[model samples]
Target: MLRIKGTIGDWPVDLTVEMDDADWARLAQNLPVNVAAPTAAAGATPVASAPVDQLWLAAQDLLRRSGGTEGPQLMSELEALAGSAGAAKGLLVRLRHSPKVKIEVREGVQVFNWVEE
Candidate 1:
């Protein structure tokens, strides 16, 4: 038996299911796997996953647009734009050490602001 409870948007969802041994055995036979390939888009470079160069560019853009943003807020926006949390985290960590990056605290929250040279 499997049960799940959660809310999506405004509605609450509660689900329960009973699966026999045969049901589990059937699912084990073939589980879908995702496979990705790198392919060039127009004149752009081939990218299998989120490219570091583009991620950096987007991070800078966000800082410039918003003046400064909280770490978690920046991360969420990056994930939405780049589709990967790993890529966002990598960008933020590198950005934190860059001399061009400006960090400040406002209302007890750390903020990252881009410093233009």
Candidate 2:
């Protein structure tokens, strides 16, 4: 299980998405418009396993439309995506809004640890 975690504004959220390498390759090979390819890796695991790019893209898209507004709407969308993925066992989201947020990812059901300010 691969996890994709991040914040939408002042809300910290985590998303668990299936990390199907095949699917990731397929998707990456055929990434949609405006969707940048995941960071390149030379190892057996393709770039799809890294959800940071996707999360960042999604956040940027939402923020671009926020008109500089800061709130929880983006966080809500991220949470919905996590639930939609149907692999999240637990999640921790904190809103610190300290001009920067921290993100950490690891193996085993993926871990998304971040502080949202």
Tell me, by TM-score, which candidate is best: 1
Residue 39 in model 1: shift from native, Å? 18
Task: Give the worst 10-residue stretch by lDDT in candidate 2.
Answer: 86-95
- Candidate 2: pairs in clash: 12-93, 96-116, 96-117, 97-116, 97-117
lDDT score for residue 3 of model 1 = 61
Count residue pairs with overlapping backbones in model 1: 0
All models: lDDT? 0.63, 0.39
lDDT string, candidate 1, 1-117, tens digits: 446699999999999866554553353234222223223569896554333444455566777888788988988986666556765555566567566778898888878988888
Off by over 4 Å in 2: 1-49, 84-117
Error of 2 at 65 (Å): 2.1
The TM-score of predicted model 2 comes to 0.27
Candidate 2: global Cα-lDDT? 0.39
Per-residue C-alpha lDDT of model 2 across residues 1-117, encoded as one tens digit per residue: 456688989899898766443554344333222334445446656544445346444444444444332233435554553443211111112212213333333343322223334
Q: How far in Å is the alpha carbon of 58 misplaced in model 2? A: 1.2
Worst 10 residues of 1 by lDDT: 28-37
| Model 1: CA > 4 A from native | 1-50
